[model samples]
Structure formats: structure tokens, C-alpha cells
Target chain A: MAEEAAVGCARPTGGPVGEENQNETLQSQETLKEERSMIKVGQKAPDFIAPGYHKGAFVNVKLSDYLGKWVLLCFYPGDFTFV
Target chain B: MSIDSMFVHKMWNDHELEHMVKGGIPYPMLSDAGGKVGTVYGVYDENAGVEARGRFIIDPDGVVQGYEVLTPPVGRNVNETFRQLQAFQLVRETKGGEATPSGWRPGKKTLKPGINLVGKVWKEWKTTDAFD
Candidate 1:
């Protein structure tokens, strides 16, 4: 647990998001809201890097890392909740 | 991805998911805490602090091609997602010259997109073929 925390600590929460919203992060919360509107098909997906469980281990899931492959971003409510 | 922590995902994969699959889910189950990723996708329920069940299919170019969001109690389907992925790959390979019919599966007949093909798909492909 401590090791995992140390590994994840290197990357700040929403690190990639903050990088993507460089200008907005520097501004007020309103700017962040304005910048992060709904993402529609035919538009580029907002890139993100989040902590994830994969292959029986913890890892950073970078959306860009899966480029060149078909990606299905399956989002469900919290696990163990019938999903 | 939902707002679940990595610890919860680990537990689920090891305890519950392993029973269904040989080694649980094959893909990465992301932990998007605080619904940050969900908010961008418009599936976040701020009050709930979790994402509604959603599936976004993205192509190789990182462009979202399809998505669906349903509340809990209505689980999503992996088969449907895989079918769409295959369809998308086929369409991409053909450069939109070919289209997959409803319930299309690999090795199934594909329709060529053109004015002549319009209203004539039935002549080439029957509704029953969707199952075959």
C-alpha cells in the first residue's frame, strides 16, 4: 500500500487533465468549466491519465498510450455494484 | 471509468471477476476518482460523485465514434462493444467504401456504399442474414 502510494504520488491527480487545460487551470474555476464541455463524436477525446487496475497490478492508464488500437472506455458506477 | 479507487478495482477483479473470466477483465479498469474523466464525457453525476454506466468506443485516431450511457441496474454489454469495434475496424479498413449490416459479424457480407446500393441492400442482403 505504501509502495503504491509512493508510485502514484509522483503524478499529481488529474495531471494530464491539468496539462491539457493549461490556460484554464491558471484561470478561475469558470474557465475550467467552459473548457471542459461535453465531448461529442467526431471530436478528439480529451486525453487523460488516471490510476487503474490492470493485469492484476496498479498502473497509470494514459488514454494516449492506447493509440493505434480500438479502445472501449467502459465506465460503470463503482465496482461490486452489480456492474 | 468511474470514481472507484484502485484498491476496489483490485478486489473486484481478484474476488468476483476471476470467477467469470479465467483471469478477470482483460483490459485496464481505470480509476477516475472525483469523476474527472466522466465530467469531460458528460456522464458524471456531480451529486453522486460517480459516473453513470457509459461506454465510449474510440478509434485508432483517438476520435470517439460511439457512446452510450445508462444508469445503474442496467448493465452494459461487452459483446455489443466488441461487435462495434470490429465494425469500426472493418469500416476504417475499407475507408467507408463498405458498411456492415445490422448484427454484422466478421466473415459476414458487407454492403458497399453508393447511390446504386441505396434501397437495393435488401436485394443483396436479407434481414435473416443478420443472424447468420
Candidate 2:
């Protein structure tokens, strides 16, 4: 569980660190830190109404539709691994 | 977790859906194709046209209870969601009777209510008399 929590916490901070040299590491670290600070806990999740390809057709789904259920909204960098 | 070509292709494919369904992903995995959800979630990369790996547990009331936004390399744990859900359920059901500590499990010890009971509760954890 601790490992899992560490994985969660490390998600936002584990950008290119070891691969880079000292100078590049410092620059990348500052940029990543700035990006992380943008998302704060306790803030309202931004709502959206968009075309979702669920079941078969591209149905319009809105954030408001999930008002009564626990929505695990996750975002991956790309379809594969370029992050 | 990479979310690059392979990840995106897998997620958007029928095989991946079947795999996730078999793997017991109870919740829906909505795609942020245009990066709208990702942008709103603050995980969107404009240059790459993709979202950063991010996870948020939004309660029934639409408030975010747990939020985790990771860089691209790491994967998320499905168990933490269950743990959080359990913790939230326990607190909601029990009202203010107890509070969950870090890494709290369902049947494990919880902090008891009261003023003077604080020190005593911590000290008398081994004793059954600590709980009211």
C-alpha cells in the first residue's frame, strides 16, 4: 500500500531526472514543479460535455451526468508512452 | 501508463477493452481524444496533443476526494481507489465516531472521539478499553 501511495505521489514528480545531466535536471525540475502546482486538491473538477465513443455510437456525455456516482477520471499522456 | 502510441492504441482498441473488462476495471475509462478532459484536469500537453497520466476520485456529490496527477512513466494502483472508497464509506456511515489514520484498512483501528481521550487512546491502543 505504501508502495502504491508512493507510485501515486511520484506520478507528478517522476519526470526526466536521472537521464538528464545536472544543468538540464534543474531546468526540467523547475518546469515540472510549476506544472504540478497548477492542480491543487479540494478544487472543483472542471466539467465538460463531449463526444464519447461508448458502447457503439459517439454519444454525448457531460460531466454533470456523473453527479451521483464516484467518477474515477483518469488521463493518460498519449495512447502509448511518449510522456 | 506510457500513453504514447502503444498505450493510446491499446486503450482505444477492442482487445484492450476486453482485457480491462476481464481484469475487473469496474469503472468506465473515458477517453480524452481531443485533450479536453485532460486540459480541464491540468494534465494536457499541448505540444504532444495528449494528457499526462492523472487520476481523480470524484465523490457522488461531484467533489474531488482524491487527486493524483503523475508524469508519464509511472502506473496507478487500482487498490488505492478501493481503500479511499472504503475510508470514505466508513466515515460517512459512522458519522463522527472515529477518524481513519494513514493506510487505514476496513477492520483496523480508528481514532476514537473525545478531548482527554486523545493521549489515552494513543497510549491504550493495545487495551480494548480504548474504544467506546
Candidate 3:
């Protein structure tokens, strides 16, 4: 299910993510191994405090600090990987 | 977020991302030590010791509105993320009085979801309208 969510919007343009219309992308993309992440919609996003790198300095950013604003939290496989 | 430390993020930001985005990423690149943050989001791969590629769109009220998780080979679209953020904001600003149709962009036709709009969406919005 997460793989389906991942592949649909990964397309460059003209397609909304999570739409089942992208049958071609569904087939062309390899089936990924089962995942364990169980994040659900409409739930409170998990909060965390961590050290971050920004513009040549280390800063502490707390998830709660960004309250009252749209937060786009992105995760990737370590550093130096293609975004 | 990933398990990368602050120093690694610094190197990547200075050497790679800045070259790609002119002034580097305009947002903070967080260091998720031990994959703690990723684990809470369920994007952490214990065996791999890294977080899977994932993005969560959290609204101003701190609710998770949208999210995507992908593997390493596939790259997520930044433009699409922006589009979604704008769409979400528009819907919120309108206080749910307006809804964005699929593939909706700013200034495009927005649907006012209601009992009357339950089944007649095709009349108010057309496939061709999305392109206009």
C-alpha cells in the first residue's frame, strides 16, 4: 500500500499522487518489499526535537515549534542520497 | 529525516545540494539520530539502519493530511509537494467551503462539497477544466 502511495506521485508531472489511474507506473516500477511504517491520515503527526544542519550552522528544530504553520516533514535514506 | 549526523548534513548541503539549488535547501536538513524520528513516523528500516524516503504533509493544526513513502531508487517530486501544500492551504483558508479537485492548481475551479454536490461533480468540474 505504501509502495502504491510512493510510486503514483513520483511521476514528474500531470498526475496526482495516490491516484489509481497510473497503471503504467504501477507495472513499470518494481514491487518493493513489505514496509513497517503505519502512519495514518488525520492523526497528530509525531513530534520530535533534533539537531539540524542549515546554512553552515547547527540548529535545534523542534516539531512543536512549527505549530500554527504548514510543516512538510521529509525523510530519506541517510545523507548524499539522491532526493 | 535520516540517521545522518549534523556534520554529514553540512558536507552534503555545502558540496551537493547548494550546487543543485543555488543557495542550498531553504529548509533545515535534520539529523535523525538512531532513526528515532523515522521510527515514530514508521518510515525507519531497522535492518537497513536508515529511513525510507517519506514525506508527510502536516497541516497548521498539526494533523497529518497527506504522506508518501518511497524506496531509494525512486525520486519524489518537489513541485508536486508544493502543489499539494498550496491546495491544502486553499482548502483550509476557505474553511472547507471549497475543495480542490484532483490535479488542482491555484486559480483552477474549486468544488464546494455539499449534499447537492454529492454526485454532480462532473457538472461543476470537467476533466478539460483542469487543464484550463
Candidate 4:
């Protein structure tokens, strides 16, 4: 786990630390609202690097890394939930 | 992708990981506990506190070729996603000259798009033949 964290410490989306400031994050949600419209067909997908679970290890994944292949970004709720 | 932690995802998919052909899950199941990807994709329902079922098919250039977001109750069809991918790949290979018709599959007829084909698509396309 320590080694995994060391490899891909680059958190582009500020995900892991986002929960620290909920109030501030909520205020920033206003700016994020405008981003909703940008995610659409024919538009370039937003690039992100996040910790992904594969083969029992936490690995960083970048959307750009899959540039030459078809990428299926399937977003569901948390695992073991209703989804 | 889900908002679950990497640990949780590992625990959840343990069976598939251990027994799968490659000894791992077929694809990368991203952990978006912060809902970052969900927010960008507009699939996060902040009030409900969960991400809606969302699927995005991105082409080689990273452009979103097809996407769908459904309410939580509805699941997705992998076959349909694959079909769309194939259709987009075919059109991309042909450089917009060919288009897949309704329910079109590979080895099936494709429609040739042009000013002349605008109104005659229905009459020109058949399962065995393509528009001239």
C-alpha cells in the first residue's frame, strides 16, 4: 500500500483531499456547474488520473494513457452499494 | 468507475480477480470516492449522494463518440456499447463516407452519405447491398 501510494501520487482531480473542505467545495460547486455542459458527445473527454483498483493493486490511471484505444468510462455509485 | 475506495473495489471483485483468465479483473475499475469523474461527466446526483449509471465511449482521439446516463434503477448493456464502438470505428475508418444504418452490424450494408443520398436512404440501403 505504501509503495502503491508512492508510484502515482499525482492527484489531478484533488479527489482524496476534497472531503477536507466541504463548505469550500460546495461554494466551488458553482464554478463546476458550468462544466456540466462541456461533457457531451463530440467533445474531448476531461482528462483525469485517479487510483484505480486492478489485480488487487491501486494503480493510477490517466485518461490520456488510453489515447489510442476505445475508452469506456463507466461511472456507477460506490461498490457494494445498490449499483 | 465507482466512488468506492480501491480497497473496497478489491474486496468486492475478489472472486473475479482471482479466477479470471488473467488472474485479474478484465478492466480497470476506477475508484472515484470524491466523485470527481462523476461531477465532470454530469452523472453525480449530489442530493441522492450517488452517481447515476453513466457510460461514455471515447474514441482514439479522446473525443466522446457516444454516451448515456441513466437513473440508478437501469443497468447498462455491454453488447450495445460494443456495437456502438464498432459502428464508430467503421465510420472513422471510412472517413465519414459510410454510416451504419439502424441495427446495422459488421458484414451488413452501410449507407453512403452524400447530397444525393439525403432523401433516398430508405430506398437505397439493404441488408445485402449498399448505396452506389
Highest DockQ against the true fold, candidate: 4
- The DockQ-derived docking category for candidate 2 is acceptable
**lDDT, residue A60, model 2:** 57
What TM-score against the true fold does each predicted structure earn? Answer: 0.76, 0.64, 0.79, 0.77
Question: How many angstroms is residue A7 displaced in model 1 relative to the true structure, after the best TM-score fit?
Answer: 34
Q: Which TM-score value belongs to model 2?
A: 0.64
For candidate 3, write residues B14-107 as lDDT tens digits.
9887888988888998998888789789887665667778899999888999999888778899988999899999989999999999768887
Tens-place lDDT per residue, model 1, A1-83, is: 33444322111232232245656546756655675566899888889999988987899989999999888887877777764
Please name the candidate that would achieve the greatest TM-score relative to the true structure: 3
Residue-wise C-alpha lDDT for candidate 4, range A1-83, written one tens digit per residue: 33333322112122344345778778878876776663779999989988987766679999999999988888875565433
Deviation from native of the Cα of residue A50 in model 4, angstroms: 0.7
* Worst lDDT 10-window in candidate 2 chain A: A5-14
Q: Which fraction of the native contacts appears in each prediction?
A: 0.80, 0.58, 0.80, 0.80
DockQ (Cα-based) for each candidate: 0.34, 0.29, 0.33, 0.35
RMSD from true fold, candidate 1: 9.2
Candidate 4 lDDT: 0.76
lDDT tens string, model 4, B28-129? 888887677788888876555567788999999999998988776567888888888899999999999999987787778788989988889769765455
Candidate 2: segments with Cα more than 4 A from true spot: A1-37, A80-83, B1-11, B23-28, B124-132
User: How much is B1 displaced in model 3, in angstroms?
Assistant: 2.0
Compute the TM-score of each model's chain A versus the native chain A and list the values.
0.54, 0.46, 0.52, 0.56
lDDT of 2 by residue, B42-119 (tens): 777755555666778777777777777766677777787788778876776788577777657678787777886867
Model 1 stretches astray by more than 4 angstroms: A1-37, B127-132
Question: What order do you get sorting by TM-score, best first?
Answer: 3, 4, 1, 2
